[model samples]
Target: MPKHSRHSAKKRRDPRRKTMDQITAENDSMTLKRSLTATQLLLMGVGTTVGAGVYVMTGTAAAEYAGPAVLLSFLIAAASCLFTAFCYGELASTFPVAGSSYSYAYIAMGERTAWNISWLMLLEYGISCTAVAAGLSGYLNSLLGIFHIHLPQWLTHTSLQPVPGSEGTALTAGWRLDLIGFLSVILVTALLARGVEESARFNSLIVALKIGVLFLFLIIGVGYITPANWVPFIPPAQANFHFGVAGIFRAASIIFFAYGGFEAVSTASSEARNPTRDIPIGIIGSLLICTVIYVAVAAVLLGIVPYAKLDVADPLAVATQIMGKPWLALLVNGGATIGLASVLLGLMYGQSRILLTTGRDGLIPSVFSEIHPRYRTPARGTFIMGGIIALMTATLPIDIISDLVSLGTALAFAMVCFTVIWQRNYAPETKRPFRVPLGGIRIRGFWIGVTPLLGIIFCLVMILPLLFNMVHALLGGNPVPVLLLVGYFLIGVLTYRFYGFHNSLMAPSRPHEQGTSSHPE
Candidate 1:
């Protein structure tokens, strides 16, 4: 490392003094483990990425939007995800850092963009965890019901929905506080805080269980499909295309959540045996595996039940009930409960790492950068993130949380794509294990990275409807998910301007210059 001036050295070394440099260097103690193979990493990605969305959302989408055309919605969403994954594959290969998109943004775009990306990640990680927690509660209830144990509504329901297909307009809800959801979050947090290696291993096991359960669903559900259910593949259009289009776009955003944990693969780049090769493979390969699974599961789902009747919170279980195989519902629910645990663990792990990075950058409090010496993990950040996620799940509505997650995730991906382009122009000499091919010399005689540019455009297009819907909802209009993102981004700006900017590493000088903070090891 280059020798710093006396002032810079003091700032870099003193943990108590609270400069960004000190925090950054403190993280130098984190050693690489290289335990995960490409297969395990891919399985980790798939475990988190293929959760409640495919199992439940298929029915939800079929009921509201294209009916039989819900499969098309899955296709549209998959196309959008594929574009983003290419960008992720390239960046993960290059950075190989624990902070995922935030670290990439820092090196490529500068500190401000890094701050913003980290800020958005707070929501992406938190809300996604809470949403899965909610799903877990549903599955838990279903599992219990199989044993003839029906809990009171106050324990299971968040809000009431009108009785399905009933003209009576009567409404019912399960319960007020979901105990199973709350407990699952706490359990996953405990497992994650233990260590990265343990968490990855646990996630891998969960992924395997999910795959097995899905295969079971495919075999059993196939036998239950009636030829009559296939009559009108596309439900005949009603007079209102407004809800049709709106619902399709909304479902698209919802499904977007199913695609996000691939970035979590990048967050573990530092620990990969060969990050340059494994990170890209993990990101892209995981996405491909999950995408195929998602589409197949959605198809098999619609095949088992008429599309119109499929839109329950737990669609797969509902279908099993219709098949008069109550035991299968319990088994599927058990699988779903386990499946969502991996999602929460993966997402929370990714989010906390981002916060740890930002804290080290002096964009947040220095406390967040503190790693446990023995574990070499950011224990403080992990626990804090767990608390936030738990509180969020205990309070927020699942729909709002789901939408916010999609928006934040998309925003982070967009910045990463932009960062890739910016880095080629400004940091061409920087060493990278992977590089996006330059298509041409600079427009103004400067070299440009076209891959990131294309990635940005694709993400932007996919995010448009999400944005519109979110705004519409916020203004009491036809709201969609992207609006929640805008709201959170605004908060991020305020937070950065007031706190992160003032304390930022890019600032001209440090307040204390007397000592160096020791690295964690």
Candidate 2:
């Protein structure tokens, strides 16, 4: 501990004295267990990325913008993610910590930047996890339907859709709760609370089943591909936004959320057996796996049904229905349910880790940092996150939750990648276990990291339109996301003002720092 004056002795032993150097030291005494392998980390990345977006959004994107050309949208999103992945790979390898982008920002920028990103991470992980869980509930309903089993209307669908659909599952009574979504959050929270290893094992098994189901659909659906669906692949231009070549980019931006699953994997750096090698492998490998599957699925889905017909809640299930395969459709629905559930597990786990980091850094209440003695996890914070997610699932629709996630992700990913460039200049001598390729080569009398530079550009391309649309939505009275963002921002700012600013480990006038009082009296 740093030396402190006698008058300042009442403060709890200040963590402000701890430095990045201290955390980076070998075999440090942090709470998280280091048991995750490359395979487990990779599976975690894959599990989160291949959820409802591919199962649901592919068709939506096709119906709205790209038509049969949404396959290229997946490829575009994947390329942007690859560059962002490259940035993540280098940082996670170098920092090797639990907070993911928040940790990287702290090392490269300062405390305030880390604080904002960590707060946004709540949207990326916790809120989105809830949305995905809600989606899982819908698919679970679809799966149960295969057995002629159906829940009451209010039990499954929300009242967000004013005119309820024919399934009689959607309710006209205002503000109906998604009972299954609420239940899934609690169940997944229990799994997370048990232990990370146990949760990871379940994730691995379930992810395999999900992927196998996707491949089965691909193999079977290939024969049903009508070549006529390929004509007029890029839909004609529409008035409001991008169409033609621009439509593909717009679709890429929407589906870009699918590739963000790897960010959750990066947060597990503190738990990996060998973070240097494993982090990069986990991030890149899983992205490749998901990208191929997403592209193939998009092609097959468009081939089976017209783009206009693809705009349902469960696109894959709809495609299977068109193919006259009810049983296979049920299997696809089950796969989506399992896939979305695994995503919830990973997101919840990652969110708690980020919360714990902020707590340890004195950005939030330190109690959130405490790890469970027996479970070796952030037990308190994980459960707290669960309750919040559960509330969100019951109140909000899946689409609204998804929009928040995309905005948060683009902001976080862009800043994280930008941090790589900043770090190169700010701490040139800092030991890097892994450096992003194409960055080391000097250009115009400056050492620039090319990958991160392009990453920032790519992320911004996706972020700007979303930002404009969000502002437009707020102007049009869709206030949920704006209200949520402002509410969280105010809470974070107030926390910083009242608590985190003074309590921060990096604070200049810390308990330990020796300084004469200005009054001197």
Summarize candidate 1's per-residue lDDT along 1-28 as a digit string, tens digits.
Answer: 1223333533533232222244334434
- Per-residue lDDT tens digits for candidate 2, residues 399-503, read 554666777888888888888886775456677777787746555434567898888888888887677766777776666567767887898788778888888
The candidate 2 region of ten consecutive residues with least summed lDDT is 512-521
The most accurate candidate by TM-score is 2
Point out where model 1 deviates above 4 Å: 1-27, 32-34, 157-176, 227-231, 236-250, 436-442, 446-451, 474-487, 511-521
Q: Which stretches of candidate 2 lie over 4 Å from their true place?
A: 1-18, 25-27, 158-175, 440-446, 474-484, 508-521
Query: Where does the lowest 10-residue lDDT sum fall in candidate 1?
Result: 12-21
